[model samples]
Target: MMPSPYPLEKDLGMRYYASDSPGIGGRLRSSPEDFVVEELPLPISDPNGPYLICRLTKKNWELQQAVKEIAKHLGISHRRIAWAGTKDKNAVTTQFISIYDVTPEAVGLVRIKDILLEVVGRSQHPLSLGDLAGNRFDIVIRDCNPEELAKRVQAATEAVSAGVPNYYGLQRFGVVRPVTHIVGEEILKGNYEGAVVTYIGRTYPLETETAQRARRNFAETRDARAALADLPIQMTYERAMANHLVANPGDYAGALRVLPPKLLSLLVSAFQSYLFNCALSSRIDAGFSLTEPEVGDRLLFANGREDIVSSRNRQAALMQIRRGRCRIALFIPGSEPMASHGPMDEIMQDLMEKSGITAEDFERASRFVETKFAGTLRAISLSADVQADISGESVRLRFTLPPGHYATTVCREFMKADPYVMI
Candidate 1:
């Protein structure tokens, strides 16, 4: 196993690379145009449906801000807008959104710079997270080592095609501060005050000097009003929490409640993602094969059916795996976790114990956040059929991943640069 060189990556439990070949060192997203994502949405249209479906294409815009602006233009509540997935602000992304009780004419009239909204169809239901079938990514890695570029790309391509650890990308945690999961850990421990403070005041060097100063002041003084005054308008969520605190005074949970429900759920889910990353890394650190299953291992099939490997079914499980029917998966624990019948379970249990979290803690978080923390299985590794093009000092990669997978995971295998380079 080849461990990553970045300390932040190690802290996130993304310790090793599946490919040991020297990476073709490069940087990703040097420009917004260099990284493009197009969602492969599932069919959700109905002729006489009440929901207006719009294909939203935006560059350098955050999804939440875009939705809020769209809501403002239509004079409607932001809650009426729904989307399949949240996209990164630094990329050129195209995805579908469902606006309830709206018309094509209204969507056409609403316009924002660098954002295009086109009426696609109507749907009987509003889009929810994971509504897409997959996503197609067109990415450029700039300023790579020119020498041995083709050879290294080939080696990495082959390795990734076989499989790479499916660790969540840096974007899952905030790229600037990476405090979402930290906030989540506090929430699961029933420390809403700690969570609110962390969300509002965690500082990172990557942040702007002004932003960092505001966060530092808040962390030191716990003066929400002052922080609100210092924080830039772009820090909408943080400002919302601060405003809530200034008014409610000591109602930390109320401060958290002011943010969008989806954002709240994502915070807790980030912690779950962190646990999965660590467990997967531990499995590799302990010399377990990512592609092989043993007695008591969980086998997850392509069709979403799951079975535990046992003395009776071990051979069948192996056969299914060889036939590309399934892969070994670890559980992402929620309020009610699925059975993980092997060392993966033991590893995750150890992590939970060390973190001082309990099942009841998740229950409390669900109630506080108003989102269900449901357990699910995730494959340990991901593979893709990649197409790479080399031209001068850069390489462009085109690939597709099923819903919920990160394109950066695939790009990191090829670039192997610092996580910040990818960011």
Candidate 2:
């Protein structure tokens, strides 16, 4: 059984903090150039190996798009290339990518727009997601009132040091279409047809009028031939699905199967993220301390250990937390043994009853392992150290966060505004 879908909800606003924080009221990522991220890998690069490690600095290019272009240039299959993780397209991002059976010199001849690829080294194994320790972010906020930014950032930065609730930020879901979770919901319910339609149609206010026109036409007609003409060539997945269905005719599941397995996994993971966000929001609503564990509360540590809260050990746990030894985390349910307590426990119970997803259900996973929803613990709060620099009307915020964490989480505390518009 697939996990039950969380509500196809709007932004689950700030958690473990109130909305009354003063607004920095600045805009971020006005241009792709405004945000920069550099991967700080775990010093694991090996120079003597069969794998080619390449440093990629891509400006305004999606991570996968960059990989595709690199593969075409190097004359290698994209499947053989690997990376620590993905970076957002709407930024100047840099990360190390690895390819198998390639020499360092052969990897250097690749070229793409706004992309600089250099052979960094050779590693014994291809890098996989979560292989990195963290990423360093340089973000610029524009059109700000300097005094307001200074005041807001100061307070926000101090709050960040105390700890920022580790909710998955808006980018995890589609910012414009906002239908990733919707499609995820359909998949979990075993509605592949619904998933395909939700992904292809279901236009929203945030989407461009041009895109809405094409998608709406496709949705109403279900004509792959017409859709191919209407949709731009850039909608590769949509086009591929259309081509597949044009021949297969109403084979929705097979059409969905045409997508890359990694993408299918992302759809499921998005739903998991949605549920995690909801649980965190509920905990905050109940006015529970994210850092301070109370009796009957369950805790997850950074070193991948679990603990149960008891008065005898709660204080000791708090001390360990302050010393950066442990954190509070919620489980993403899978076909594995796990448990939770306190406000998080209530949220999970509610979600479980609502979603109808049980641990055993995860055993009946999709063909791909990534879609397994194999439960894992995630931190509820992060001890982020945000460094804010105010220069006239523009502010530059710099910070480093653990892998799988979003920098926008720190900025949202200061922005106190809608992510769709401001960031």
Candidate 3:
């Protein structure tokens, strides 16, 4: 008999597959020829250039902090410096940042040791949000197979050439399913206070079924009621409704389409949480943590210095900056890709078939490959290097993914590893 599906467990399983395995055709460790890493540079500015744009490479620095440092050096506010998006701090990232109201003379004034600030190009208009196309990434892979490697490379190249689905990457939400659960719980308790608190506190756990149920309920409610109606409506309920409306403007028709009031509230809450989670994920990917102004110093930027932001601040910031246009793609690896086909492979195969995906889809999900390496600090080291020849050994892959997709979804089919870190 087939086992009853546990959504949470299934989610965890998918994560294991994506992170632990290599490729779909049993190519665990790549030989020299099989391993390949390439970076695609994204378009920053248009051809017409009078605008002072700089493409600098920073070694071991967070993108946001780099922006702030550059702003301070140039004697400009952080808001003035604009970039396409944020990059991970641990990895050496080369990106473009523009300083408006600065000339070629002033561009030369900024200096930082790790950061190399130069004028890539310039334009009359300042670089604003969503100003450029996607970023181009340069990646390096280690260990590869010359023969089979060619096929794998062809597959990856083809996939990217065809636009990959822009789903939210997992980094947007807390590891696994914490954000969903927290929002769910808050909605069910009718506790706007708790929901607000959780957004600020970042204290929600990943495995709360109650919270998940609440979130589901909220989604149902919003589906029912199109607008916020008054029947002795409290301020908290009104605010919650307002938040729901902002997060899900498209759902208004759907909310109105439903008839019952109870159902309407639930749907509104669900859509609200979804929007909130999406925004939160984007900010976190950009290196901001959750925080609350009311909490003051407890959850401020000062407290979230180590690449960890408060859930509250992250979610609130998301609400403030969300444009409902962000999209992401999560890459997960499977066992077949690692070349270790066993009983586990059969189980994963069944799951994949049921999910309407093939083994190839899992293998080619992302160009980045993650291998498990033994290290002193008990860390999950991510490298862009691919090891295709060594079919049995594990390797690490590092790539910058957009917000709202799960890294683990790529490795759940492989063995479980501790100390999984995504930066």
Candidate 4:
């Protein structure tokens, strides 16, 4: 196993790379255009539907913020806007969104800087997350070492083509402050107060000194009003939580509930993702091959059904994996009771025990967030048909990843640099 050199990555359970090649040292997203993402959405067809489907193209913009800007221009609540995927703010991203009760003329009239919204079609249903088939990425990495570049690219490409551990990217947690999982742990442990405190008061070194000072003051004094005075207006979500605390003292759960339901759900989901990362890494650390299953592994088929590898089906599962029929997957625990079936489940159970979490805790979280914490399966590994090109001191990668996969996971195998470089 090639352990990651970055400390932040290690903290997040992304501890190793599938490829061992000395990476072609480079940086990603030197500019917005350098990292392009085009969503492959599922078909949307309804000529006279209530929801207007618009293709949103933006450069260097956050999806939520961009949606809020569009909502402001349209004089509607941002809740009316829905998207399939949440895209990074630092890239050129084009994806579809559904705006309810809005016409194409109104959408066309509304515009923001570096943001293009076009009415593509109409849908009876509002778009939800994971509505896309996949996303195509055209990324350029700049300032790479030229010596032995081809050799390193060849090695990394081969490894990535075979498969790479499908760990969630840095963006799953806050890029500037990776405290989402920490907040989640607090939530699952039934410490709503700790969750609120962590969400509002935890400061990262990457954040500005003023932001850090504000958070520290809040942490030290537990004074929500004082924090409000120092907290930047741009810290909208944090400020909202702090304001809630000021109005209703000692209601940490209420403070958390003040956040957008989607954001609150994500805070808990991040913890599930972190556990999956750890289980994947532990599987590799136990000398198990990613694609090949042993007697106690779980197999996830393309159709979303699951089966356990057994003495009777181990060979069959191996053949199925080789033929692209299914992949090994790990479970993300939730409110529903899922009986332990295999080694993967055992790993998760151990993790839950160690973390002081249980199915009941997830039930409490589900009630608090108003989103079902029902469990799901994630592929343990992913492979992409990579196209690599080089010009002068840069390298470009073109590939498409299925919905829910991260392009940075592929890029990391090639670059193998600090996570901040990719961010």
Candidate 5:
């Protein structure tokens, strides 16, 4: 029999830490100074193939909402604009956005205040999807102790230098696992629309033992008929089993020879989910999120409460540093001039001690974090910035990471010092 969907230990064997701390619970703490909202002018180069580059305060706005605002201002559908990646709604973010089929003259006619839309350097080639390498960020961290703060900064620098593990951020599970449960149920029901919607919404839950076993069986047998026949009631089981077969080369060949078209499709989806989760976990371990600061990339960060931003901003930056608060931010390449170095393990250990996380709990959490980093995607470049006066007691941090990395894995290290809110 497969393991239970809910693990008794509550660790769930997933690398990303889901904290039991009170209030909004997750890997990241709430900060008032998380984001610096601004609308900067876009630089223009090509007037013919008119593309306007806009920078967003990633910490304050949702990627989807930002896109919508741009689309509306440009008199085009949301489909017309393109971006490199999504930015976190809680921290400051900057990136470029492009408007197609519109001339510079036409673009000049548009007006919007919330977005700092201006024409930056334009290209003859229309800004297609995935046109950016990465994003650059300027984050501020406040209210921290000189000694502890120095130690934390040194540790962060070291971790970045050594290359942090890539894991999926907690956002992938959709705000306390709601999306995951929704997708799991939808998959079980064979509701394609529901599954797709939830997946797009970033609501899919972490893989469970039953799901894993089903996937493994599906891959091994490549016999959808048998799987369906055997597990008719548990569609998730059948799908998982088929997907496992598709991912393994040996299973793929077996399934190709034995499974029918319907089963094949199910297998394909299963394979896709496995691959995606792998990427997601890898990115998280590396301290990154799926949303890029680029164009044409659809990413979402849940900014449930507007007050959180203000609260973080109201505190003294120095006090936050003294408190050893944990801050979360996104970083992009070349956006800022700061240097980055090393993984955050040592800092995590220190903060864990301060936060009162027992050595045993830390060990358990470390295991899950390790599992997430063992996958295919390896860590790439790293960048750093700080958030000050966050939540009147803590500091916020931003790191520029590669695609498919999570920021929470690093956040878990600071859980000892910084309490978080999961909205």
Candidate 6:
């Protein structure tokens, strides 16, 4: 029988390459102003293209809602709008979005509460994922003792210089419900119907009382009809799936189809991230340094393949590290091509077997519905331009990280507190 899945929470099972330090207890995201992010878009040539790019700054707005609003005002489908990346829902963020043939007059007409949009320029090519060099962050951590905070900061600085493990931020998985991966695991097991149940009926102990009751009732009775009333009306995806199940009864696969393709893709991707986290943690436990590259480890910026010819492979991989040209990384299993050598390979394979998967599942899982995945590289450590300042009861941190790396992971190295407690 399979072991019970690990609980998803802030910092649960995450590995820390930096040595632990005493944390100065503080609260993050005390307000939207406390966290700020701006995209560092890739360099562009002349703005002589068919695509209209806008620099949008949003405060306390979710990306999906903001996209839908822009689409409505522009008289186009949501799919017509494209962005380099998604920003935090509860953060102050600015990023570029490219829409084909959009007029400034139409952009001015967009009115999402707390969202501000501006037409930056025109581009021939739409900004796709990983188009940014990184993100710049300005953050404030409040209510920490000055003395302890300084020590923590000093420790964090050393860790930063040495490189901290680039673990996924707590926000990678939902903070409140943390069920994206749970639903994904069921999907991987070929239980389409079970995925719906897990989404609607699974409850965590830390969840709100109302949510707990709703999920517990559904889990016990397995009745979509009853759960619909119990689930908050704001849960449109859950409500849609439940409504379908209530009417169609056992059409599990159809129920899974209720979510939009982008959202559906996110669920599967989140699961892959979860496994990546586990694999990285395993490698750390076996004594890999976040700062150094080893013979068997794949690099973030290196082109990887199934056949890793041995002769110059180790020398080439290590050369990138020596020049700090590559970020350390682990592969998220799925139709993605990957190669691991030495102890790390054994560790990853062990994790696969424990999860009821063979080494082949890495490539086999790409066929699942809405589960589009390809082998990709992600850095396990990052290089950042960080600055810290102290003012009264708060510590202000400013930095820029490479694309796909999270600022929260950097903060975790210093705080060393339960993600909930620190943030």
Q: How close is candidate 1 to the true structure, as a TM-score?
A: 0.98
- Winning candidate number (lDDT): 4
Name the 10 consecutive residues with the lowest summed lDDT in model 5: 371-380
Please, what are the lDDT tens digits per residue for candidate 4 over residues 1-423? 598988999899898899878999899999999999999989987878999999999999988889889999999999899999989889999999999998789998986999999888998899988999999999999999899999998888999899999999999988889899999989988899899889989999888999999999888888999988899999988899999989999998899988877888889999999999998888888888888898877788988888888999899999999998899998899998877878778988998899999899999988878888888899999899899999988999999999999999999999999888887
- lDDT per residue as tens, model 5, 232-339: 353442344345444643343333323222223332223223333343334455544322211111112222111111233434422332232322222221111222
User: For residues 63-135, could you state the per-residue lDDT of candidate 1 as single tens digits?
Assistant: 9889999999999999999999888889999999999998788888997999999998988999999999999
CA shift at 99, candidate 6, in angstroms? 2.8
Please give each candidate's TM-score.
Answer: 0.98, 0.92, 0.39, 0.98, 0.44, 0.88
lDDT of 1 at 90: 90
Off by over 4 Å in 2: 1-19, 337-343, 368-371
- Deviation from native of the Cα of residue 342 in model 1, angstroms: 1.3
Model 6 weakest 10-residue run by lDDT: 1-10
The local lDDT score (0 to 100) that residue 246 gets in candidate 3 is 49
In model 3, where do residues sit more than 4 Å from their true spots?
Answer: 1-51, 128-133, 136-166, 174-196, 204-419
| Clash count (model 5, backbone only) | 111
Give the 10-residue window scoring lowest on summed lDDT in candidate 3: 373-382
lDDT order, best first, reads 4, 1, 2, 6, 5, 3
| lDDT comparison, 1 vs 6, better candidate | 1
Better of 3 and 4 by TM-score: 4
Against the unseen true structure, what C-alpha lDDT does each candidate score? 0.90, 0.75, 0.37, 0.91, 0.38, 0.72
> For residues 359-397, could you state the per-residue lDDT of candidate 6 as single tens digits?
344344456564557655566675565788878878888
After best superposition, candidate 5 residue 349: deviation in angstroms?
33
